[model samples]
Target: MSLNRRCSRTACGRPAVSTLTYVYADQTAVLGPLATFAEPHAYDLCEVHSERLSAPRGWDVLRLAPDPNAIGPTTDDLLALADAVREAARPVPVTVSAPSAETGREVARKGHLRMLTSE
Candidate 1:
């Protein structure tokens, strides 16, 4: 039993390696890497199906391939993720600064909001 997501084509149960989406306004069919999540309008395709993909008359098919030598999820990516998590988890210090004359004073405090007096 394979855990891979299957191709969207009917009767083709092969694992999907790419994703296909149509740009109706541009008359273009884009084939790129497998999406992080399945979209309602996008179609997941296997290698064979992706290679055999075609567009209708006056439509262009754009195949976006990954860089051959580029390897992702490196140490920098992990470090950046960790840094972002730490920044998000860190407590935000609250400060009440004196309002300038032009800005006016805060009149009412509401849920995640504050009403200010007009000048």
Candidate 2:
């Protein structure tokens, strides 16, 4: 393996984005991201490195992505995860009933929520 844990695949340098945690019954393997070389970047282990990843106690792991070089949980990582959650939670389009007598008042009172749930 390369000293930097870079992707073993030639002509590609994308860093591993996430670890492929494999669980087979009781065995598991944690594959680490190998590398990615550009923006919107995610590095992942090459097939070779991925195959080599061995989980102690026979756990099977597949692969991870982004930068495997990234070590330790930091505040930034937590914030990033939170941002991802927020992005995923973004509302999709929903059908709304026409304003009823009370509905107009409800909408007026819940304008903020309406905006939040808007498509």
Candidate 3:
């Protein structure tokens, strides 16, 4: 349940405080607050790494101010989470129709499991 992500730097076990992403085409590096999710191309950096980060010789670095209030979830975040929980808890209507032989594949799914029909 831990939401914190570890820094991408080797030997640095600190929690990530910022995210680093490079724009190859523009030869620019962007450093900002930790992302809500781990992006495949972005690097998660600790406070120290983020502060000490330097771009390549020809690259420019863009550092964004990390919002102090973003360290924790806000009221809107809590309310959104509550709304999502309520939505998930509500019963969903599932209309099962006889599968046509021509289209035997599963048409839809919900959550993690699949509803398979025997052909």
Say which candidate scores most in lDDT: 3
Residue 94 C-alpha lDDT in model 1: 47
Q: Write the per-residue lDDT of candidate 3 for residues 16-104, one digit (tens) a residue.
A: 98899999999999998888899999999998999899999999999999676666788999999999999999986654544545535
Worst 10 residues of 2 by lDDT: 103-112
| Per-model RMSD to reference | 4.7, 13.5, 5.6
Q: What is candidate 1's local distance difference test score?
A: 0.83
lDDT rank, highest first?
3, 1, 2
The residue ranges of model 1 lying beyond 4 angstroms of the native Cα positions read 1-3, 91-111, 114-119
Tens-digit lDDT string for candidate 1 (30-93): 9988876789999999999999999999999999995566455568979999999999998755
Pick the TM-score winner: 1
Candidates 1 and 2 compared: the better one by lDDT is: 1
Local distance difference test, each candidate:
0.83, 0.49, 0.83
Error of 2 at 115 (Å): 20
Query: How well is each residue in 1-119 modelled by candidate 2, as lDDT tens digits?
Result: 23344453467574433335444565655555433232233335555545555556544555445454556557897999899999999876544544545323222223235422232
Runs of candidate 3 with Cα error greater than 4 angstroms are 71-119
Which segments of candidate 2 are over 4 A away from where they belong?
A: 1-33, 36-70, 93-119
lDDT of 1 at 15: 96
